[model samples]
Target chain A: MTAITVDRLHKTYLVPEREGGLRAAVGALVRRRRREVHAVTDVGFTIEPGEVVGFLGPNGAGKTTTLKMLSGLLHPTSGTATVLGHVPWERDRRYLGQMALIMGQRNQLQWDIPVLDSYKLNQAVFRIPDADFKARVEELSELLALEELLRKPVRNLSLGERMKCEIAGSLLHAPQVLFLDEPTIGLDVAMQRRIRSFVAEYNRRTGACVMLTSHYMADVEALCRRVIVIHHGRLLFDGALEELVHRFAGDKTINVELADEHPLDPAALGPLVDGHAVERSATGFSVRVPKAETPRVAARLLAGLPVSDLVIEEPPIESVIEQVFEATSAEVDGG
Target chain B: MADVATRPVSGRPDFSKVSFGALRRYYVGEFGASTANNLAYRGAVAIWVVTTVIQPMVSIVVWRTVAGPAGEVNGFTSAEFVTYFAITMLVDHLTFIWLMWEFEWRIRTGAMSPLLLRPIHPIHKDVCDNLSYKVIGLVGVLPAMVLLVIGFGGDVSGIGVVQVLTFLPALVLAMAVRFLLEWVLALSAFWLTKVSALNNLYFSLFLFLSGSFAPLAVLPEAVRTLAHASPFPWIVSFPVEVALGRRTGAEVWVGYLAQLGWILVALVLLRVVWRRAVRVYSAVGS
Candidate 1:
């Protein structure tokens, strides 16, 4: 079953135009000028039940705008979207009860109260029974290691600890669909890994559909198997993570380690790989080759040089995503 | 993505239709939580109490000086002025709604987004918070009322049981009228960036028209007539007058009827304004 279906979703804002200095301020007082800003345009995608999809995009690329529309915090300027068989913008209570939107920077918890108290409030808002609420709290606490943190006021907790509590609080109702926008934006690597693992485990246990947006590539790599790339308010690619790498990442790096520490001539390995430069190091040299020619290039390197070890690796997912965005920018510039 | 079966999760309730019992439970929980949250800010409440107490105390002193110890002004003796201002303090404390200031902060800070995503309407939480603040504020207000009565020698010997009974409904309706009307006004923050000037203008009008500065009869005939034409007098002065036995029998009933009328009008205005405000917020992005 489809957990979410968004088709041709668009959001345009009428921003008041103003310039600095007294003259423009006085002019604005007499008659305000507004300019149309298209935050999201013609965005379309679908997420199946139990699927974890990464929403990848650069800044101001409408990733957050699209998530807001999916979560019903925004109404599309003109388009349609449905989550769990309900139109999102209609904001049916049933739909809201079964979905949770967690913005990493925005907090839903009452600042002055204990985290557990906020969770209890969510129990009331979502109408969770006492027994179920207790059980879920215990379970989430254990998963997030939140036993000690729950009793402290939310403002007293650090960002990582607070984020863990936030995730736990949002899940008290066991929402069937989760929309996480930059769920690990400022956390350290360990905390990010922990959150990623917890989300994967949650999905495994409950089979909830998750759509996550994050600037951290490790977050996407750890939690999501499928990714939906968006740029300029349009869908660029939507498929498996490996497929994204393969399609957008045209070149693979080949590292060759020689038996002895010696600097190698760049021209020696130039013909083996393409005309790409060979980066020399103390014990090894690395070269870039086309995805399809990596194997041939490695074979040639092993036969042509005193190579002790050789490794071929796909470029990092971050570079691939950057290339995707850069390619889009180039297309816009060229067109 | 492959198609998956639509299996209903266990232990999930049918939230499409919320029952009254569940809603009551939710409200009770929200009220309790809000009350606890307010307790954490006792210092802030104390500061607020200083302002709340001083406003009425200053008004009473001015009216008492105007009435002179033995003389009466606008049919209000010095003692009657003390009673009226003391009761007005309590009545004002109960009916005041600060959403005009709070709503602007919520919009500017993007705090309204989480509220918008919730299954319940955001007003329920605000109602709970408002009630909780008033309930906690009474701790400070009661002492202030006692001090004012002791210091000013307020005499309530003329206030009978019937007037006391009648004041209860009037106070409740006045709170409703003020909350609903001010909530409608607070929606202006959705369209305007700076609502402080608007809020200040509103509070100024309310201060003069609601008898906070002085009882309506003490004002000029034209201004008193204008006060009666607006909902402000019905919100504060009517309840204080009922408590003071200044309005009796049929007059009390008329006050209730007028309050109910203003409440109905405010309710209609709140509904219209809230819908448009949400539409604007959704369009502009919270």
Candidate 2:
């Protein structure tokens, strides 16, 4: 079964608007004004069971809004969505029990008590039996490295520790669907990597469908094979992560190391890569060419130069996503 | 890697069906957690009890001045004045909820996101939190009540078996009515960014109409009639009046009816407003 099926899901909010200064404030007493913000519009995608899909978007690009709609925290202004065959907005207990929404900025754990106690509360709320709760807690504790954290109050833990404990607490229910919005936000690089790996392991162990949205592309690259990109409240692209990269990256970077350790000049290897400049290094040269021209460029470089090693790689996902956002924004603004 | 059928999830015991055991377990678990949370800030709970004690003591002193010369005013002795304020203070403590003050902050700060994500209705957590505060607060309040009765000479002369027995149930119902009423009002934060003004209006009406300001008998007749139109008196004053043996026979029954009526009304309003409030919240992005 498809873990999630969203069809033309849309959401809009009426935001109160007012101008600065006392005159406007005084006039506002007599009347109020508001503007409609279309947060997510006609965004549609299906995430298969056990798939870890990345929801990629720039700020105000409706990634969180779509996640909220799927998690049952918000209702769409139009269209429909379902997770595990149940409409999310209905907030059915069956659906809720099978899913978890973990926001890095928000905590679901009780702050004043030990993380273990908070898990106990969840156990009762989720109706997990005593033996199962103990075993699950142990498993999550081991996975999240929460041995010391289980006894410590959430307030007492450091940011990374608390976030780790928070993630562990969210997963105690072993939800089949997880919506992780910036789950690695504000953490150190190492902590972020730790969280990403924990998510991957959890996904592997439980077969839960995971949809993650992160400003850190590393988080997505580490876990998601498929990605859905949205911009200006509209779905811009949806496909495999590699395909997204190829479609939007526009260029592929090729780095070559000369067999001899002499510095190479850019013009020496130029006119080979569509007149594009090559950046020379002590070891070799590096150049970026159009995505379609990557193979030809790499071949020409390897055959033409005393190349010891040559590697062709797609541009980073961040640049690709940014390009997607900027292009869509331009089209939206221009139109 | 996505096969949880063997390690499948468990749905919490839903309350759609009547099951006392499940109800007891859930409430007890929540209550324990809430109690632990409250205990973490024992100083705050202590300070809260102090604030609760101050208002009634002030009211008692003011009313005592009115009965100065003869120790009696409007057919009531000075002792009765003390008793009235004392009971009002206790009832007020039992029924008051602070969510109206916190709801605006929660919505603005995005603190409400956690609660909304949970499977259970948020009210149950709030209810347990309220109960935990009261239970912990009673440690300070009960002794204070005893001392106030002894220090200020509060009379227990009219007290009897029936009054105390009936007061218990009325007090419980009043707490329910008041809690639900305030929670419904707290939902106003969904639309308004600041709720302090609305909360201030609510408190002022409650003070005036609920007999916390003065006994209905001593207040003007028109005000008494107005008090009947609102749930404030039923939540705070009527319970106190019952405990004092002031309301008798059909009057006692009428107060019960009013308390029950308010609970039902609050329940209906809570359901309707809560439904709309969630829409507003989703629209507002908190």
| Number of clashing pairs per prediction, in order | 1, 2
Model 1 clash pairs? Answer: A1-B4
lDDT by residue for model 1 over A1-335, one digit each (tens)? Answer: 69899889888988889999999999999999999988788888888999999998998889888888888777789988889999987788889999999999998898988888888889888888787787788888888899999989999999999999999999888889999999998999899999999899888888899999999999999889999988887889999999999888998999889988656767766776667778877788888778888888888888888899998899989988998999999998899
> Taking the tens digit of each residue's C-alpha lDDT, what string does model 2 give over B215-235?
878888899899989888888
Clashing pairs in 2: A207-B1, A207-B2
Report the alpha-carbon TM-score of model 2 versus the true structure.
0.94
In model 2, how well does chain A match by TM-score? 0.92
Candidate 1 - CAPRI tier?
acceptable
User: What's the CA error at residue A173 for candidate 1, in Å?
Assistant: 0.7
Where's the lowest-lDDT run of ten residues in candidate 2 chain A? A261-270
For residues B22-83, could you state the per-residue lDDT of candidate 1 as single tens digits? Answer: 87987888898888888998889888878899988888889899999899898899998998
For model 1, the interface Cα RMSD in angstroms equals 6.1
Against the true structure, whose TM-score is highest?
A: 1
